[model samples]
Target: MFALKMNVLMIITIIMIMSFGIFGETISKTNSETKLIADLLAGYHPKVAPTDNGPVQVKMGFDMSYFDFIDEPKELAIAHGFVYRGWNDHRLQWNEADYNGTRRVNLDRNTVWVPHIQAANSAKVTELLESQVLVFSTGRVRFYQSLQIEFLCDMDLTYFPYDKQSCNIEFGSSLYTTEHINLTASPNRGTNGSRVNSAKDFQITTLDVQRSEKSFRFIAPYSFVDVTYTIGLKRVSSVYRAKLVVPSVLTSFLILATFLLPTASKEKITFCSNMFLCLLLLIAFLHTTVTSTVETVLGQLLAFSLFVDFFATIMAVVSYNIKNRGTSILTRKDYGIMLQDTTMDGDSGMRAEKTLSTKFAWLRYIDVISFIGFSIVFVIGLAAILNQRE
Candidate 1:
């Protein structure tokens, strides 16, 4: 009886031991998973907030072990992309900060930044590896890290459809036309090591675009705001082209008008001079509008217009001289010698009937030809100027 009782006691003890062991293992696994998730959440803390001037502020954060992919020592890697001082360029707005301390930025303006990370229980990331993934990784040394990024910018709001709406763009007239633009970005931190220190996933979030007109400014039906975000690629900001079509057309016309004026008296000279002066003034206006603005391939085209105008002014002066002076002056030059002799001798009629005609028969023909040639040149120059693409 005693032996049987002991055997029962032993069986109960073994079952209890087995149950305790299973329970302990389950709790350990649960704790490990929770720790893993907590560590990752601690790393990402990107936020977007409002600034005084109505633009949003974006801020981002990242940890030190993140740089191991590029062979950086933990100390150096943690300091990889911090904005310790002022912004490197105009595109980035940085706050004046204590350089020796941790790097931080005010996202109240457009900028990109990175901050130092702490080294504690850092582990290598091994399982997650994909060539297309934003994170860069090397198998040798792995680390668990986090990254945060934000954007502070005004939404490109289109109360008027940017692609379809017709807006009157005035150079003294209103025409229905569509307007569009391209936006781009530049790195503001660790640019020298940009290839290695860039954010794994820099993203824009919390965009707000709104439009309002006077009568019911704040009402929802009358006005609305839209918001959306996605991964974005950064591009260099540059002037794609320079367009000055109206000014160019006006300049060309001024050149042509010089031909229409009479050069028989000082009035014509004064008029041509005034027109020339106005053209010069217009060129100056164009120069002022475009100077320091940017020089593009299109800018070179505008320059060509200026050159054509300069040549036109010279031609105008030359034409004025030809018209005011009689055939006597022009005939002395080698170019006009034959032309004038032909026209003038014909006017004299001195050799009429002697040669079955006059020596000036060709001269009369020359006069007709000169007028026609001048008119043709003027028309062609005007057409070229007016036809330029805006």
Candidate 2:
């Protein structure tokens, strides 16, 4: 039993020794490779372009992770993503076999020549990754920078909640013109495994990338390459319809109901006044919610409501005046009955009664005409609003 225990201990010690030896060798090899990479970059100038003759072609693209938020009033959209850039640096190339088959090395971004690319329409940009890059032995350099970018979006809110908007993000070299650098779109540029199609009140419908060239005059005309990413967004309007449209429509019906009330009753004017206040409140709510300076369907609806309110209130006053005039002439004490005695006073009373009846007929005519006019206008306006959805 003592000899068996001795053998077991010997085996364990041998295994541990072998493991340490392997680990030491790995560490030594890694250090040697790192030294070799350092030696290769000893005389390199990071500010100089890695080319001898023509412009260096940089493959650049964006991989969108998700949408953060969209501020409609501010016309800003925030997105989280990675900016990918690749180029060849011939000075950094080395034989991998001499360094124990080391194919890739990581270097600090500050120690290399990087293109000065920026978003032209961005309000602000925040970096969210470590400042490092991957360098391959074949002279290929790759850089990935995670960024949270806020892009300026010029939105058209004509249709408001049902509106479709297109926002553009422009990327270009800020310092170097086409003479020193050429920008090319990477083939794999676009959304990267992101399932987020909706953000807050908008849904992404389309993403398009395009390349173009623009001329800028510094001392002379210098052309620069620009890559633009267009994002198509459609507003999700279920909430707006419930909060704005449905309520406005109900209030419109209430405005029409003012005309349906008895002309003699004082409630007609009171109803009109209440509806005017309600319409004012709705307008105020709309202004607070959607701070757009453009003309919109909801704005048109509110304006129409005001016009209907004014017309209804005027008609209500006219109706009250007519009722008062009829009452003064035909006393309720006599139950609006004319005397049959053939006298001058009786003739005058008869004529007054006829005039009162004519006035009542005109009041009815005004109510019918105003109601029909407003109803037709409301239907046309609703149709117009619906047609604006695109």
Candidate 3:
């Protein structure tokens, strides 16, 4: 029993010693990496570019994660994404053997030379999340930052609801010209295999990356490298078609139906009045729902509705007047002669009815001509609106 107890104590002592040795080794290696990082940044200047001969080539890319919203009135696109920038810094290089095989190290972003990239056409200033700089033993430095950027987009709502828009998000160095820094598009310059949650009204159709140099008219002519990401957005028009277009067309047809009512019916005027009020309400609804900056297909439809309403109103008034009050085209002498003739024949009622029919026959012709004319106008307007689709 004594020997067994002694053996158990020896095993525990050995385990404890091994644990301390491993722990000390880990601390020693961490210290070595810390010392190596300090030595690398000892003579580094964060503000200046790492290259001494030519401009530092920054390979940059964007990976979009979410599309928050697009404000059509403000012409702004807000999105969440990651920005990747990588370059080489010879000063941060070290031999792995000298630092206990430390091939990579993470340093605070402010302690290293980082390219100052910004969106040139941003509607709001973007603040990037704080992140670390990854430095490899081969002098390659990589940086990643998450940001929410609001970019200004020039919108044309001419074909709105069925319209497709192209918005550009341009990124470039804020202070450094092309002579000091050059930006290039990295291989992964898009959504990077991730699903982007876009807005309900819009679907992302295309994403194109273009690199160019733009010259600025400073005291001296300076050119800056620009990387622009063009996003093509197509509107989901199902709601507008159901709510706005279909109703507007039905309202237009109802205005045409106003002419079909009997000339003697008092409901003709009331029907026209109702249609006119409906058109006014539709126009008001359009103004409230759609952007008023440009003329759209719906706008054209409303304008045509006004003309149809005006023509219908005139016809309704004429029909009511002719039906209620006898025509005065013939003079009183002619009527008196007809009355004497009818009295002599003792058929005055029949003759008087025939005279009234002859005078009011023109009302039927007016209704037919107006209906045909307005129908032609409606067909032409619909064709034009349909042809505008791109």
Candidate 4:
């Protein structure tokens, strides 16, 4: 009986051991082989850092897939791109094939020591998604990082709707001195890639990347390396040309045509005054909405038209006074001659008619002269605007 009990006990112990072994190998992850990876990356920081002359070289480049103007008030531009920072980190390396056949892994950004670069213009980063770390057999690792940037850029909008602008995306290190981290941009510093060609209001005219160095303080050697991306933008003028320019031209034409109205009609003065007021309102609206108080060719022309209309108003008044005075003189002289039995009839007729034609003769041709003068100015203004800086 003792021998039989020993055999039973040994069998039971063996079964328990086998069951635990199978479960431990495949089911229960309490003791995983990945623990080796965890321990290796548990506390790893990049070894490469700034040298004496410069910070450790952190080669920076971007693939700009999306870009748009988000705010007009603050002059803010938003760019969606992949900014990859490359460096040598022997610390984050392992034989992935030997370790569960893993070639890469997704890691937390905080776990890795990344460059702390900022936009020189105080732009902010909006989104920072998941980071990826890839390991090769040679202990080389590459990190893929993404960022969504919203920054204030210097925008030159001189021509406005018919204008082209050059804006910049400048970057530099804020926290680290030049000794700790040297940030450099790639080729054209960066590219808008293929997607920016379809920008709505602005077209990419030039993508220029430039590198410049500056020392912030007045005291010592506190210098920084910066990358500037000058994006040349040409306004798609078809919309403004159709919406504002065409209508303004037509309105100006109407204003010029006002001279055809008979000077005797009371509507001539009122009409010119009303047109001038409307033109002023248009100028004010453009100033408020388009490009501040700066005047455009159209604005200049509008101002000139106002002056022309004011002169027309004066001429209208003068002509009316002349006609009325001529009529009064003729009536008085004719009545007096009738009272004197018509001895001065010939002289009276001659004096009344001759004085009116000779004195006010210029008034008869005033409309033609005004039209010619205005036409010359209008043509000159049109030519100048058409040849406005590109």
* RMSD to truth, every model: 21.8, 3.9, 3.6, 7.7
Task: Give, for candidate 2, the lowest lDDT window spanning 10 residues.
Answer: 335-344
- Could you give candidate 1's per-residue lDDT for residues 1-390 as a string of tens digits? 999999999999999999998887667655544443343235333232112333222222222122321221121111222211111212222222222121222231212222111212123223232211111111011122233222222221111001011111001001111111111111232222224433332211111122112223344233211112211222111121123445544554454454444433455456556655655565565445333212322233334445544544555465545543533443334332344355556534343323322333443344345445645754664454334221
Point out the worst 10-residue segment of candidate 1 by lDDT: 168-177
Give the C-alpha lDDT of model 3.
Answer: 0.80
Deviation in angstroms for 352 in model 3?
Answer: 3.8
TM-score of each: 0.26, 0.88, 0.87, 0.74
- For model 3, name the residue pairs that clash: none
Q: What's the ranking of the predictions by lDDT, best on top?
A: 2, 3, 4, 1
Weakest 10 consecutive residues of candidate 3 by summed lDDT: 337-346
Superposed Cα RMSD, model 4: 7.7
Candidate 3 C-alpha lDDT tens digits along 261-331: 87656788888888888888888887766666238776777778778888778888877787566644444
For candidate 2, write residues 1-390 as lDDT tens digits. 999999999999999999999999899788877787687679877888866868889999888767744666777789778888999888888888788778889888888888889998899999997768798999899999999899888888778767888888899987888888889889868733335445768788777788999885763566888998888778788878898888977887678887788866788888889999998898888877667623887678877888889988888887788788756665434534443334437656777667667658877877888888888988887776676554
Q: lDDT of each prediction vs. the true structure?
A: 0.32, 0.80, 0.80, 0.66
* Tens digit per residue, CA lDDT, model 4, 161-221: 6767777777677666666766676565366434553368777777666777777665248
1 versus 4: better lDDT goes to: 4
By TM-score, who's the top model here? 2
Q: After superposition, which runs of candidate 4 have C-alpha atoms over 4 Å from their true positions?
A: 1-37, 41-54, 94-102, 122-124, 128-146, 197-199, 217-222, 321-331, 334-355, 364-367, 388-390
